[model samples]
Target: MTNFLERLKSPGDLKCLSLGELKQLAAEIRERIVETVSRNGGHLASSLGVVELTIALHRVLETPRDQIVWDVGHQAYAHKLLTGRLDRFDTLRRLNGISGFPRRSESPYDSFGAGHASTSISAALGMAAARDTMGGSEKVVAVIGDGSLTGGLAFEGLNQAGALKKDLIVVLNDNEMSISPNVGALASFLSRKMTSERFVRFRTGTKLLLGRIPRFGPGLLGIVQRAEGSLKGFLTPGKLFEAFGFEYVGPLDGHSLEDLIETLENVKRLKGPVLLHVLTKKGKGYPFAEESPALFHGVGPFDRATGMVKPSRERADTYTTVFGNTLVEMAEKDERIVAITAAMTDGTGLTEFARRFPGRFYDVGIAEQHAVTFAAGLSCRGLRPVVAIYSTFLQRAYDNILSDVCLQNLPIAFALDRGGLVGEDGPTHHGAFDLSFLRPMPNLAFMVPRNEEELRRAMVTAISHDGPFMFRYPRARSEGLPLNGTPEPVPIGRGETLRGGVDGVIFAVGSMIREALAAAERLEMEGIRLGVVDPRFVKPLDRELLVGAARRAALVVTVEENVLQGGFGSAVMELLEEEGLMARMLRIGLPDRYIEHGSRSELHAACGLDADGIARRIRKVVGADTPVACTPRARFTRG
Candidate 1:
């Protein structure tokens, strides 16, 4: 048979296929996904689980005209293939290639951009409202996973949509997993809804018996419908949804192609807000993914046959492992020490923390805002809470971090992981903005570690501190540095001078310190003497070091992995302006624009943050004889 997937140019092509052809297409999509993701390594289990669901949606709805907003976009592999992007599928998650998540800019078929969780229903509701206003009769659907429901935003979106009573379809894809296993009240409720044997038996039996009546069958069905609320309250778990003003449908099998198509077709004809509960397996097609969905959720390149990740190059320890291990050790000694995460137990390396100190570990389930405030509440009772979350996800809790934690001067420490350009996941996952956003806030101490040892030291400093303290580290591994047996607290707002120079001074922070040092070595080849300083704290702005460096060197350069605006560079620039320094300044960091998905090396080179780029730029700014260039690169000039 000719490959149906090859002919599938668009959703319009999908509509022309038979049910059997559609199943074959689904199989082909799964194979292509397994092949591509085996090499590229992305959200494998989630995408494989949603093959049938994706096909059913595209077949039922006229996409582009009709919008489908996918939550998190973790399961968008099949959607990407169906929406005229199959040829470019090989480039998924590569530098300047197709994104792993849905990007509105990339395609009109992608109704909304999603990288973060629990935003799809809101986006879809907004689209539905816009359609009503414009007198457009387009259908809008939001496919959300059960994991997203743990976050309060999904309910907020549900509440608003329910009250508005708009024609919106919210498909609840309940796969019983979310990176880690699903937890909390909502997960239990959904589980009850999915596994209620009594409800299933009663509902099926009632429908069958009613249809058997010759003359009074239609009237009997109407009578049963009228009494459904009272009758279903005892048997079904949909009463909760009924309270929210959404017409609840299903507990349907997400893998059943025929059932999904028929159900979706019928649901499209119905009125107000509808919540269709779908049951699916996370890694539906593949056995290895089915066995350990969490491991394969977002993986590196792996063996397709054996399902083992390709052996990584020998390197130093990752920042996540160091942070997790150190925290466990600290928590063992201090009874007040507690750990919290937002459904990233494994990703954040908190699996051991959860194992060793289960009583102290809290997995808040994709809720960053709740995690912060919860940590603050813990702090109020004299418990020291360490909230470890990815840098990008932490942005969701900015207001909470400021108002609840910072304003009250709580002693909750934030261990921000993936604190720089997290390659492949792209702009949404990058922790570039944490320093920029947190810098202006009062009563908060920010620290970035240069290596594993420094990470341990910073962790110690944060724990010993009395108020809100944050320590950020990159996604990359440590520089194979050794850790001292015991962690020592470094003085707050202090910086270490790695090298001294008379020509120019380079003030680097965190991950940039290594690159800055390399850049200095390259500059020396051209007889350009450049100094390197690791200003450990971004918030406190190492005043004495900045003033002294400015006084000693004719040219001053600030380097960081964060963006220029309101970041480490901005803090230095403010200090230089305040101290009345006559030294020339250049800030090297991420540009004003949002960076695209790529490797860290690719992004670093593109942003001129790599060693070679830094060396070239430093030499350009500070010539052998002259102090400052007559005309500086417009982008690097902070002022």
Candidate 2:
């Protein structure tokens, strides 16, 4: 047989292929995805699961004209292959490479960009509405996973689509799993396999037979339809979608090319909000992925044959691991402590906690907004709730964090993981704005931990405080220092001087402290003396220490991993200005623009946040161009 994948130039080529050829192409696509992801480290199981469904959709629909918005675009790797990206497939998620998720700027086939979940339906509906306004006949479809359906935003889109009564298609990809096994009533509802093919055939046959009857055929059909509504409400999971004014289709086999293509070809002609329920297995073709779908959902590069992840060069425990262990230890001593995650039990390092204290753990689905308020409610009942969420995902619940938690001064501890430039996943997943946004909020204490030990102490402080407290940590490994003693609550709004210098001072936050220290050491060798200060709390800043440091040093610099605007650097600048300090100052951080996807080291260097970059900037600012004889090292101080 010929190589269908290599010969296929675009989605239009799929229309010319036979069903057998399409199946072969799917096999080839899976091979390509597995090979690439095995090397590149991407969303494996989700992409592999959607191979057949992607082919079927591209085959039937006139893509580039007919829009298909994919929810949480990780599952659209097959879609990327089917589009004109096969040549560049190897570069997925790499710096200056094709994105892991659908990017509108990258291709015309990608109607809308997606990295986050539950936005597809609304975007597709908006496209459909625009098409209607312009009187265009283009078909709009949204392929959403059962997991994404659990988000409240998906339902909001559904509610609006039902009322507008536009011609739209919604492909419900029921794989029965999200990143973690899905939770909530919607997951349970979609899991009911009551609407089988046999039931569908029987219902169709009965309707046809009744229509064939004499003059009373119409009356008999009406009675059967009314009865069927009640019956479907009891038997099928699609009654909820139907009640939302959609014409519900079968729960068809998503992997069956013939069934998918035929059903899609027929459904394309239907009008007014049609939902096609297609059942699929997560990690369908890959054996290893199928066995542990969640593990492979968003994985690093691994051995494709043995299904083992490749070992990293860094041997230290990740900040996430430390957080999980510390939380579990803390929970052991306190019964009022409870943990909550918005469907990221494994990612947020809460799996062991959930197992150890099942009753106190809550996986609130992909509902961050609800998770915040729900934690607030839990706190109201005298329970200590720790809402663990990725910094980027927590942005979705900013309003809730402000109103429900901060404004009310609730004692809820928010552990924001992935608090800096998360490599590979890119701009959509980067946690660069947490400090900028949370800094100005009232009645909230925000802290950035420099290492695993500091993170443990920050956790203790957050829990001990009687108000809304949030702390952020990076996605990288912790500094290999031993986690020696029991964590204790540190004084709030305090900073410690790490190294003392006479010429200049550098105030660094969180992960940037390492780079700052390195930069200071390098400057010392070049006859320049610099001091480093770790401002633990960004919110209740140590004004006295900061003002005193500024008064002593000729030049003061602020560095952080977040964007420069409204970030840690800005906060320092504000403090210095208010104290009437006239020291020459420079701020180093992420650029004002959205950062592109790249390795953390590369991104840090690019944004001048690395040791060398920081040194160069400081030298340039202080007008120190020539290197002289080495000077004595600055005095090292802990506090």
lDDT of each: 0.87, 0.89
The digit string of per-residue lDDT tens for model 1 on 1-639 reads 879999877788877899889999989999999999999989999999999999999998998899999999989999999988999999999997899999989999999999999998899999999999999999999999989989899999999999999999999998883322232233334434433455556766888899889999878987887786655454345688878888777666788887777777777866789888787898888999999999989998999899999876857779898898898888888999999999999999999999998999999998999999999999999999999999999999999999999999988899999998999999889999999999888999999888999999999999999999999999987777877688999898998899988788899999999899999998887888888998899978789987887777878899999989989988887777666555578899999999999888899999999999889888877664457422323344343
Residue clash pairs of candidate 2: none
Largest TM-score belongs to which candidate?
A: 2
Question: Which ten residues in a row are the worst by lDDT in model 1?
Answer: 177-186
Error of 1 at 41 (Å): 1.1
The parts of candidate 2 lying over 4 Å away from their true place are: 177-222, 624-639
Each candidate structure's TM-score, on Cα atoms with residue i matched to residue i, is 0.91, 0.92
Q: Which ten residues in a row have the lowest lDDT in candidate 2?
A: 177-186
User: Measured by TM-score, how close is model 1 to the native structure?
Assistant: 0.91
